[model samples]
Target: MNEQKIFDNIKHALGEAPRNQFTTEMHLQMIKYADNLKSITAKEFCEGVGLKPSFGTEFSKMRNLTQRLKAAGLNTNQL
Candidate 1:
């Protein structure tokens, strides 16, 4: 399925949560698609994940920084 379609399905399945809970649920769902996501840029990943631009930017920053931290052998638990 296409990006929009995938997220639409995710929304249907996990749409009942409050705003913050909804976002967390969405991220958990995205974990299933990690291998597929690795090939995409942040913008593409956000689009695929069906997040609004602002939220997508935050997600992108979180993802990029987390990856950077991991590569630097830093523990994310300190965050």
Candidate 2:
């Protein structure tokens, strides 16, 4: 996907309002879960967060964000 679209999706998933609202704690939780896991597909990850898996590519995309978010101090849950 394009960078703009990817970013937009991430923003939506994180529930950032038009006013730029965000919850650092909730993001941290998502990040933590992404870090220490194996064989955990992106579809599964999105499902855990109440998102639908639209395409097979979502897993890779989400995985990348998960790592970045984790590095940014987002806490992840153990699976």
Candidate 3:
């Protein structure tokens, strides 16, 4: 492919990146049992799961996903 085409493809791929970057097994657990962790701080969450506090950023994203689910009345609590 041409240089410009390569750049365009890269950009497009970036824009189409997966919506969720929290792909670790712990992250999946966090989503599945979202209610259990929703009320805790990210640091507390990381500590509970033996992860670095720096992972708090990704934990926050998981929280956002659950929050949206709750707001839309899809939470297990709501259902």
Candidate 4:
């Protein structure tokens, strides 16, 4: 998909929730590691994107975000 479309879908999935709100950093990281997400786990994806990899830590959040992305037709298999 196109970059703008991908980004828009991600934003929609992220929503505007206060806690665990999506930030520009995550946005950039998603874009940066878009390709890797299809194959690697979220924890690995986080580390690949320069973030700490936490096992069973905040994994649910990533899974939920990925679900939202999938619902938005984002093809989050990479995520």
Candidate 5:
């Protein structure tokens, strides 16, 4: 994926500046949360994170955000 494009998309979706600091633990926490709530759906995940899930776009967006987080030095499995 185009990392910059994905980052920009997340920034626009969140309506906030990108965070420069995030630890592996934090990434894992979010991943775990997403995993645990199987039925929660990506729509719910976006809602929990304070985003609208009405169009089903947030689901893919959330995945991209997490992937970007991982690329930003957050470990995928270090919770």
Candidate 6:
């Protein structure tokens, strides 16, 4: 999917909710987007997802998720 579409979906799923309310699916969507993006910064991802770049830990986790998903050939255990 295009970056805009991915960002819109991520925003629909994860944005406007408190971080604690984010579901695993929502996070996975974000991680998948992170992986799909060839070169993106935390600031750029946050902007695209309508989030604050202050969420550094979350971004870090997303990067880790990207690696894990890639290592596993993008196969994921759906929740």
lDDT of 5 by residue, 1-79 (tens): 3433433444354444345533332333345333344455556555555445553453544455766676798664564
RMSD of each: 5.9, 10.2, 14.1, 8.3, 11.3, 3.4
1-79, model 2: which lDDT tens digit per residue?
Answer: 3433433455465675333544453344344443443466656555645556763354565557887766786555442
On lDDT, the leading prediction is 6
What tens digits encode model 1's per-residue C-alpha lDDT throughout 1-79? 5666656765665667677687676555554443335566667766655567566555555555556556788553442
Ranking by TM-score: 6, 3, 1, 2, 4, 5
Please give the TM-score that candidate 3 achieves against the real structure.
0.52
* Tens-digit lDDT track of model 6 for 9-68: 778777565778775655677666665665777778778877767765577677787777
How far residue 23's Cα lies from its native spot in candidate 3, in Å, is: 3.4
- Model 5 segments more than 4 A misplaced: 1-18, 22-26, 52-78
Q: Candidate 3, residues 1-79: lDDT per residue as tens digits?
A: 3433433433444345466643454455455456655567878666655567887887788767877876876654432
Whose TM-score is greatest here? 6
Q: Candidate 2 regions off by >4 Å?
A: 1-33, 40-54
- The parts of candidate 4 lying over 4 Å away from their true place are 1-24, 27-36, 55-60, 72-79
Per-model TM-score versus the true fold: 0.47, 0.34, 0.52, 0.34, 0.33, 0.66
Which residue window of length 10 is worst by lDDT in model 6?
Answer: 70-79
Better by lDDT, candidate 5 or 2: 2
Candidate 1 residue 70 Cα shift, in angstroms, is 13
